[model samples]
Target: MFATATRNFVDEVDRGGLLIPVRSLNDSIALLTVVVSQKGFWFWQKPKHVPTDFTLNDILTGDIPITPVLSETDFIKYNGIYGDSIQGSMDATFIHSNMNAAGKDSSKLELSFGSLKKDEVDVRQLLRDTKNSVLDMSHSLIKQTQKKRQVFGLVKERIVTSQPCSVTEEVQQADQCGGTLGFCGPKSPKVSLKDNGSLSKDSNVTMEIPTNTTIAYALIDLEVKHDGHYELCLMSNKGGFEVDSRTQKGLLGVTGAVSNNPDDVSRLAQELKDLSDHFQLLSALPASSKASLLKIVTDVTEDRAALGALQSVLNRMLVEKSANIADVSEAHKQSIQPVLEMLKESECGSVAETECSASLLSALHLITSALDELTHESLSALRACRSPAVLKITQLLVHCLCESGESPASATNVGVLSEDVLANLEHLFTSSDVNLQRDGDAATIQIKQLQKPGNRPLIMFIALRGLHSLAQGV
Candidate 1:
């Protein structure tokens, strides 16, 4: 009866259009029986020979070859012999399992490939098509397996604990399956930005950004606009700011999908649009109102939204000169003392710290604008002020000018320094104890010590810019 059942199964497989060799079919049945009955024995023994010719007696007596299929070069050469029949069986099994697990009727399982005209068979094309079909089936099986695991509470924990499964083990499993699955896991979405700071829907950059993190970094290809150079910058709060020239732009883009929830998507879009609207509103404000806004901004210490608003306003004012020079100067005078105190305690913070960096940049802009507006008498008084805070502010202004050359479009308006400011800068240059030397059309300022070690080059670069500004003014 068992032999009759096996013969009936093989006959059914053949009738279903699978042309598995009769010997292979018998061997497969024998191997299945051995696997079911002596599972412990078979689990310990890695089958060296393909099951196509093995029998139950061979498995029971441990007479089967112990060679791995992958180690056999001849198996690869003759792969076409068994590949199609084996793959077809696997594909059918996978589909049936998936449909059954999904609570669908598997009785309707059918293999139809439309009508094929009688013609000379291209063996290579046939193999290629079969390989691709198998791959597609494998991918579908993997996805279904993941879904079933999630549904049945068999999902593996991604996080590590003191229990059985570790991250290392999970990684090893992925590595083992990567060749068959094409990848270890799903990839994240990536978005690119052009040099002009416009986001690109299609870009070559590949990086993943987490769903929860509001801030993301991207590589901007400024080649067309910035002398074929690229830049690395932060993207957050609906704006982008360059980090530094030293930071190369590579491996930048959104790494993951956005939220799938429609409400989350809608809310995010609305927030971004609101930020743009706020910037536009601030930019359109009259000069006097903007000056008042700057004053309010200086008083804001911890509110990120307020800081962003102020930064937007300041950026517009610097770029467009929308505010009156006198009004800006007055606002600068009111805010300069506080900003100077901040500078004394700290060096310029990272561009990532939107509040601190934006505030500092805005204050520097106001000071430069004020210096450009100052009368010679006022400038002389500024030189006479000679305080450490004053010196620090001067150094900060010069640094802004020097760094602005790297990104002229986004830099402060330091190019228009008045003769009065230039003379005062020259006085500060001559009086400073740091080594100051000229090397034919270029000035270098080197400082030996700084309150903050990281700020040494910052001060030196700014002082050098001040010297250059004075030279150009002269």
Candidate 2:
């Protein structure tokens, strides 16, 4: 019905336009202009009802002028739509009033395309935000780069230059005996106005530079050479050649991991195996023995961490039988001189040097308590003769002693070897003992007294006790 009515209205308006009252003509034309403009049809075709000179405000106010053609036809068909509505209305003025009222009501219906306010998309603020974010990212990247360098232990190389100097001279060997002396001739004393012990006017006085000022550099590079043999150079009151020095083999049993030699590694493995066996033996030993061992270990050092480390080293040297002995006797004495110097820094001033200190003997007894009585007697005999095995053991004992914070027990009886025990020890030296008498002759015991400084007797005693337990079937 609506389509039929719209078509009929369009046909009628095309034949003869609907007449509006002269009084309501301009209002009718303005209302029609608003409708046309609101429908967006005036964008393509400039409607005759809306004049080129008419602004949107004029149209909305119902004050725009109608073209002559639009006035003649009352109004164009408005694309043949809404024509019937206006034509069918009862009052022209009422229609105009209603249209204006509807337009005002529609003006209150605020339409928006997006939710964001105008200030939200401000270009200046957006640019500043973007710039700040970029700077932050660059700083973060720089920090990450520095972190990576630190993690990789990368050190930036820097050019190191010596201090600026006016003079330099290469040193010579003869200059070590004090450089050539220069004789200074007598000079006349300068006469000062203040020599009369009175105040005088201040005057700038220049200082004279010394004529003998010299800067010299000695080019000396001490290259340390490593050979298979360990050498300990010692200075004594007697002579350097007085003591017999032997070439050391393998690594210090406890420090074998640092050695590159395959033999050292093999020895270290064997030592470790022996250590494991010793622990197993300890576990199997009587409870009393274990208690005694524990007490001795606890008494050795108060520091638990140092105790653990010392226990491992001591076990390899004392508890574990068949330890791979390195000839670190003289080596230790040379190396530990610094430690002894440090020890001298203590309030005690210096540790008393004795041939066989009771404290050292007590420590040795505690370490070698696992050995049999017969072995102890044999060890005493070996000590008397100054055996290398005993010497090595003594070096290890000194190392362990240094590791301990407290002084060892001073109560001990390092008794001399009995004649009977020595006589009984002779059987091993006889041809009957195949191991000792390899050439089928009595083994001669060579006793060379080393004039080496320090307590030789103490070294022999400690090493003897340790060797008793450490040597296989001693």
Candidate 3:
């Protein structure tokens, strides 16, 4: 019956069973049966002629043809750990021998193979030795084959624990968990169930290794001092400042054009004017004052008073035909003339014009005298009337000059301004008080000189012009 069934086994066999055939013998006309007892088989056949070493590129480009020694089905069958009747038969024989050796001297029992006494051995002892040998060989094979697999990416197995611990103990625990913890207080944190849960009076906390914890455990060890619901906030001493790279690039381009072509200077002035007009409402609000200096300046541009004062000064410079104001060249004067005309038209012609022509004219005389002769006496006189307004207007004017690439250039011609003057000028837009220094350098003589009630605008103007020259080169 076995031989008859084996004959037709090729046609009736299932691929998912233990009796699967190897690739070489699968479709042969002759009855070729090969039983594989081991998990894997070595390739016994070698190539007739070994090829020369070739680059991986050759294989990728199909220059080298690849012929696999075994198909997928055959490889899987050969490398599979499948159990057969051999192991079961060995176990059954051992069990039968042990049963027979019961209540007898097992060493005295002998076994003969093929009627040969020389090949005989004690049955019980031989069975025990065979079982031990098989077990030892299997253990050795498993140990030799075992390997520690390496995996990529963030696959670290974390065991989160909510164990109650003191602040000192938490430091060690946090280190153990890769420092995924915030600040902790002196006492063990009270585990609150509700938003307004009552605090625990008990000081003693049971300490034990936590068995289970999820990833949703709290990182912050909060201790509510007197809470109805403790509010947590993150604060920073440094102000939040951001620059619009696109707008900055556009301003840079405009400045470059203004330096080469004086007519383009009016466009620069117009942009500044438009910015002020658009953000006047938004910048005047209380919240806007608390915003970062860059944000406020970019949003607010210059106030109405500043624009009015600047327009007045530019008009006088044009009418008087002054060779230059400080380091402003004749070319710069030609540039200023168009901007002045635009400001003048905006001041008087438009319905949106808020500042009366009278006030602007009045402010013009004071500003004109200050610019004409930059003496302490003349500047002091101008500073006495609307001191805060004067500083604001001056800062805006300097900012406009810098933005327009027409700022006062220095004697050095290489740099914008002296370090002291540059530092002092930065405070005007950055701080609430122009006199204040962020770097604690207000006590320095240079800073003190620039911070004087009247010297603020003159020093800043010097810095502004230098910045303009430097910007052009940039």
Candidate 4:
């Protein structure tokens, strides 16, 4: 019976899975599968190609050719994470995208932008929801946790866990990281049982771990601090493995997080903190990869490991390529702008955005300037961003006037300084910011004794024509 079912499954998947093939860089079939993975599906191709403006999603809905196989690297990366890479059966119409030629095609983002934008919005919302959930959790501790020193270890296995946590129904909606309260004191946290029931004062947390952790557990002794319900978190490493109880599932990230027992806020606060960090990275990435990273962030966020992964991506982009913000689009620019504003408005010095504010935007401009600077140097194969970190770095660089940007020969810089520019900068001269150097040398501007004081004063920086605009406007 099982053998027959297996055969049926293979035949069904083979019939339905391979139905439509196309040249989709971001294979749309995968998108559909993400929503509907009731059965199983096979995706032989990977997204090795960075499409111009097009997406493969549109092609899958229509008739198209089979998308070529992905490069070995991408195939491994994309598959290692999202793809299940198993065989199963489901009868359905197969479609492959062809509308987009390998090199010549309109942008997919342009065609089905509604869906793409919606996908991004959904990611943003998911991030918000995850954060809010953690913050709303009570800031207390779990007075009691089963102390068998729960352990699991192996090279590959998630020590999954879920517990109840308490929280006030009235949660203050924060920025992208979402709702939160003032700093939660582990000694005493705000708890409301009616809102959260999965946790109790003596909440029981079930932690899952890989076998490697089992080895770590055997190694060293660790110290822990406790304040009321929240037990202190501990980390240690043994010979072949490591042990960590600070995971959200442990008592670190989830403050009031607990089972449905009504009141438990052990790791919830930490969970919210980590969540905020993930969005920090998200808001920094380019618009293109912002969507992809949004998906990954949403998944890892639930587990509270998003920051680790996000930081890895950031290191890759910033250190590896020295990529700046100007590389991405306005779409990405809009995405991070809010978080920056929120940090200042909320006066959350604790927030990382505070430190990254001006620098982030400046970096964006710097990169754009760099791109403008490098435009004439030389071009190479383009590796598009696939993560939020990549998106943020690229987006920040688009605004600069660098060699990589518009060239003098593109048209003409004859009207080098436009009237508009002059008008905007006029205040610089009149702002009472004495143009003086500490050394008493001509500070802001160098002025010469023109024939006489009443005569037109000749300034070193501004020309008479440039001055005319500023003076006349005043």
lDDT of 1 at 153: 9
Superposing all C-alpha atoms, what RMSD in Å does each candidate have to the true structure?
33.9, 52.3, 41.5, 30.6
Best by TM-score: 1
Compared with the true structure, all predictions reach lDDT values of: 0.25, 0.23, 0.23, 0.21
Candidate 3, residue 206: lDDT: 21
lDDT of 2 by residue, 1-474 (tens): 111222232233332222111111122222112111111111111111111222123312123332211111112212122110000101112111211101000001011111111101222332343231211112332234223221100000111112221211111111011112111111212222221122222222222212211111001111111221111111211101111226753222110012222122233233333334333333443333233333333232221222223323333333233223252344333322222232222122143543212223234333333221112123323323222232333333333333342113331111222333333334222211111211222122211222322222232223333433332221
Top candidate when judged by lDDT against the true structure: 1
| Candidate 1 lDDT by residue in tens digits, 61-120 | 123332211110110000000000000001112211211110100011111111111111
Runs off by more than 4 Å, candidate 2: 1-287, 290-420, 424-456, 463-474
Number of clashing pairs per prediction, in order: 9, 0, 2, 92
Q: What would the per-residue lDDT of candidate 4 be over residues 1-474, giving only the tens digit for each residue?
A: 111111222232332221121221132222112110010000111111111222222212224322322211110000000110111111111121111101111110000001000011122332233231211112211111112221111111011111221111111111111122121111223322231122211122222221111100001111122322111122421111022446523322111112221011222223323323323533444332332223322222221112222322233233343333354345444333333333233322454764554334333222222121111101010111112222222122211112232112222221222233222222222221112111221112211221212111111011111111111211
| Pairs that collide, model 3 | 407-465, 408-465
TM-score for predicted model 3 compared with the true structure: 0.16
- Estimate the lDDT of model 2: 0.23
* Clash-forming residue pairs, model 1: 48-66, 48-67, 188-255, 207-255, 208-255, 209-255, 223-228, 398-462, 399-462
**Structure candidate 2, residue pairs in collision:** none
- For model 3, the stretches where C-alpha displacement exceeds 4 angstroms are 1-333, 347-355, 361-365, 375-474
Model 4 local distance difference test score: 0.21
